[model samples]
Target: MKKIRIQCALLTALSFLMGLSQFIIVGILNNLSNSFHTSIDHVGVLVTLFAIVYAIMTPIINLSVGHAPLYKVLIILFSIFAIGNMLTAVANNFNILLLSRLLTALASGPSMSIAITLAAAITPPQKRSWIVSWVFSGFSIASVFGVPIGTWISDNLNWRFLFWIIFILSIILIAILYRLLPHNLRQKKGHGFLRQLAIFKNTHIILGILIPIFNFSAVYIVYTYLKPLLINKLGFSTNNVITILFLYGLCGLISNQISGHINNRKWTKTLVSFLSVQAGSLFILFLTSNFKWLSLIAILFMALTMSVQNSPVELYYMEIAEQKYPQSLVLASSFDSIFSNVGVAIGSAAGGYTVNTLGLGYLGLIGGIFSVLAISVLLILNKVYFQ
Candidate 1:
């Protein structure tokens, strides 16, 4: 029993670290650009590289590390994460920083995928949703606290210190995981990488993968350039901008918890309702950028929709994975991470271009259109495949 408790804690901590590593860039972009003597566009490459590497590596790692003991795999991955964070702290050149980011991304794919797999492994079938939600809540928490704290550290000290802080935390998490997680637990044979890839031949798997692509693209389109939009177009003070982001994060945290509880009860209706709300939120953001208070409200709603959408989408894919290739569920999660990161990179690139060319406010409009399109696709998919 105590061992199980420790496993849960370690998994949640790893989840938190994975999320913080991914998003800490959002709050430190200006500092990074200035310190590196580059433009924000150049700094954006860090995010792009991270996402691209994460997308490309997820499936490859899962395939290569087939049926390994869970503890051993986690130890190896977390050590890589620790090394990556330490390198980022001391990186002196832009190229080295980019390399460190790639290393971190490489580590992140397995760490996050394994965390989810572990949660599912330990929980009873009836409680799987709760466990998955508990694990993913780490991301929501990171959004609320990690971004703000990272921003504070970057502002008050050198940006290098932010990585150092995470590095220290990684060390502690590694120690806890080594001590607490079970050593004998192994992957089921059916989940071997090859079998997982084969499952993608199914139409449901294809649609499941595409849903994340569209959903994340819509979210990232506005999210990638949010700081600039808030400061330049919305006329928000830096402090206010941070505060609004915090609010957005908080709303997301609440929504994650709520969605986890409600998903098993009315999965389909919950998804449609949340997607509709997201569409509405994006439209509101497009129309109300000039009004500071209104924009804040819109962002809160957007956060709510995003948080609600994440778990259901994941659960949807997991269910399809179970039916088609039960053993390869972990591989499915890895694929999800890869595809989702691809979406993030594409969306960020698209959003960056649209903001530069069309106007920053246009980002919300673009995102809304994609959200609507994603919903339409899902509806069609549901009618044909799901039903």
Candidate 2:
């Protein structure tokens, strides 16, 4: 247990860097565009490109490397990730910066998938969900806190400093992972890429992959334009908006921590309850837009439930995969990451469309509709499968 905990912590750090590096781009997009002599929109595409690459590349990489020596694969992937960060820092033009992001995204998806796989492989069945959730919370933590810190650093120092920090942190994690991960955990008889693709044949697995997309589309529909929703719609000043965001992030971090301890045996109920409240929060946000205190409450509730859905849903995937597709455990992790990226992209785009068409205040109402759609999917999943 002690050794597994240490490995989990180290893997958590790796996951944190993955989240940090991905999101830090948003913080410094203008800086990057200025440095590269391009449009901010072009630089923003780096974010979209990174997600697309990660979503597309992860399963492809996993088909081949799934059964390789785990720690060694991590080392190689982390090395690529660190070097990509370094390349980004030293990039002279937009093309080089884009290349760096592509390399990192390619490595990041598989690296995180492998980390989650190892987390599951090393732990007992009963604790696997908790461990995976713990690992993923690192990403949540990075999103809540790291992005702001990176933005602040960019404001105070150089924008490249963010990647420098990530590169240095990743280097430290390499040594920790080497020292912590058990050497004997690798398997040689895992499924090939084509065989892993067979998971799509399983209806439950497809639904599982789409779950994040549904849930995230709900959350990010409002969250993507959160600042505007808070200011233009809810009438918050800039500093108060930051404070509200901070509170929301704190709720998210706490929610992720709580998610790690949830009972998987009742995951259907757990998922439904959280998703219901998630939908309710958006509903409340939609209704209470004019009431400052009520609006803040809705925002906090939204943040709290946004991440609490992770562990149970992940547990559901592992349980389903373990029972139906034992050889595709790592592939499940890759799918999780891949689907999550797709979710964010879809949600952001949808939110942008809603703001343009219906208006910003209507974001929560539309987001509520998305969450309700997710709830409908989960209910059908439970009735058809879990029962």
Candidate 3:
């Protein structure tokens, strides 16, 4: 158990770097704009580009490398990741910086999918979800700690320095992974890339992927626009809002930790309850928009339920792949990462439309609708499949 925990911890650190690399851009957009002599709006494209590339590249890379030993594939991907960061730090122009980001995005997706696969490979069946939850926490931890620290570094030092830090850390992780992962780990028999695509035809696989899409879309609908809502509607001062955002992130971290212990036998009820609470809290935020403290509590409650579905849903995909589609394990593991980006896009667009059409106060109402939709999907999945 101790050894399993250590391996998961290391993989969590790998996830932290990947998450930090992807999200830290939001905090340093101004720095990037200033350094590259471009508009902040233009620099914002970097975020969109990274997401698109990551979503498109993950399964492709997984398919390409499915036959390779997991350890070697991880090392190779991390090495490319290190190079991407290095390129980001040294880029002299906006185009070069964009290129660097593309390079990093290409590596980031596959690294995470493979890391989850490696975690499952190393751990026992009973503990796979626990280990996978730890892996997911890496991104939560990054949002909670790493992005803020990177923002601080950008404020005090230079944005380039932050990538340098990532580069150095990636190098360290590569060395650790090379030494830590077992070389003799069995590789599942490879299916042709076209053959693996057949998994998507399975109703269970498609619905399993949609759960994240709807749930994440629900969370991001309000979350993506939270700072604006806090300032424009909730009447928080800018400085206090930063603290509140940090507190909200801590709630997310706690959410992930709590999710790790959820048992599979009880997952259907647990997932439904969590999503129900999430929907209710969003509605509470809607009702309490005029009441400052109550609105704040509702927002935190939403955060608390935000990640409850992640571990169980991901564990479901991993288990399904292991039992029914072992050859597509890496491809299956990549689904959450890929679709979650799609959800972000959908939610952000929906939130923007709502804000333009209705107002900030209605963001919660819109988000709650999506949460309810997620619940509907879960019910369908349960009745048709789990039962």
Candidate 4:
């Protein structure tokens, strides 16, 4: 009825907010560093810390809170997110800001996975992918609009106001969610946390976890340091950099939607093809950085390939989990989040080290290597599992 429709809208909105919180940092990095009287390198730690907390806390939170009533947990987590965003807005020092970022990240762990689970719970199995895709589209939209708008705000107004905006959005989402979502959507009896954890023993589950790590390590190696590459290597102005990012986001949005449709037809081959193109795109980017237009085109290609790869990998994990214990699918999603965030942390650290020790030009080279390695892993997995 109207209730279900409202629930879906609220959940999708919350997903968008979660994604905006995660990526808005990228757009405001310069402003934050200047405000805190720190270097951009130091501000980079906020990204690392947020990824690390999300990696560590996702499974722990899922296990502890999975059996709770979904609506109650959603409200509590959204409220915590609001508090975190508000704290970040008012923080006067770097330490306080870092702490606030971690707090916001903690809320993110449960919010996304729980939202996915709720969507799945409401939708029929046959239409689950469509529903999940609609919800997850929030992430693509965040990268497209949220990051650019945040950057504009930080440039035109105060950076703190960006967090204030997020806080207001979180508060609004809390109300919508409370009104829309079912109050008592909990299993009467379920497998205990320990039992759910046991599902990790499956080989497919372990492979699924590692695939995200490998793929995202490649992604973050380039993306985390992209701004500097555009400025220092390509000699682009600030305005150009933001505009190019907006284009990259637009390409990514289209590619993600296309990939979702492709997944229904040829999941394994689509993954392999996208990863291969991604590796090739990174290589081209590294080699072509001196050419402004060519480098921008390379970025577009990278975004397209990476977006095409995302949904298939996510769908692959969900499909594999379906053959096993269905309830543990939520844990599988949690593992996906953990490994992907861990990859972000690893890739960012590696890229940072390479940039400091070697040079910025080496970032795309390292990223290409990681992408190739990920492809190799997937090829092996495909042969073993699909064959």
Candidate 4 lDDT, 303-330, residue by residue in tens = 8766565556666666766676666666
Cα-based lDDT for every prediction: 0.78, 0.79, 0.82, 0.78
Off by over 4 Å in 4: 1-6, 187-191
What TM-score would you give candidate 1 relative to the actual structure? 0.95
**TM-score list, all predictions:** 0.95, 0.89, 0.89, 0.94
Better of 1 and 3 by TM-score: 1
Error of 1 at 363 (Å): 1.0
Which of the numbered candidates is closest to the native, going by highest lDDT? 3
Cα error, candidate 3, residue 342 (Å): 1.9
Judged by whole-model lDDT over C-alpha atoms, candidate 4 comes out at: 0.78
CA lDDT for candidate 1: 0.78
Total clashes, candidate 4? 0
- Pairs that collide in candidate 2 are none
Q: For model 3, how does the per-residue alpha-carbon lDDT over 277-315 read when each residue is reduced to its tens digit?
A: 999999998888988789899999998988887777777
Query: The CA-based lDDT of model 2 is what?
Result: 0.79
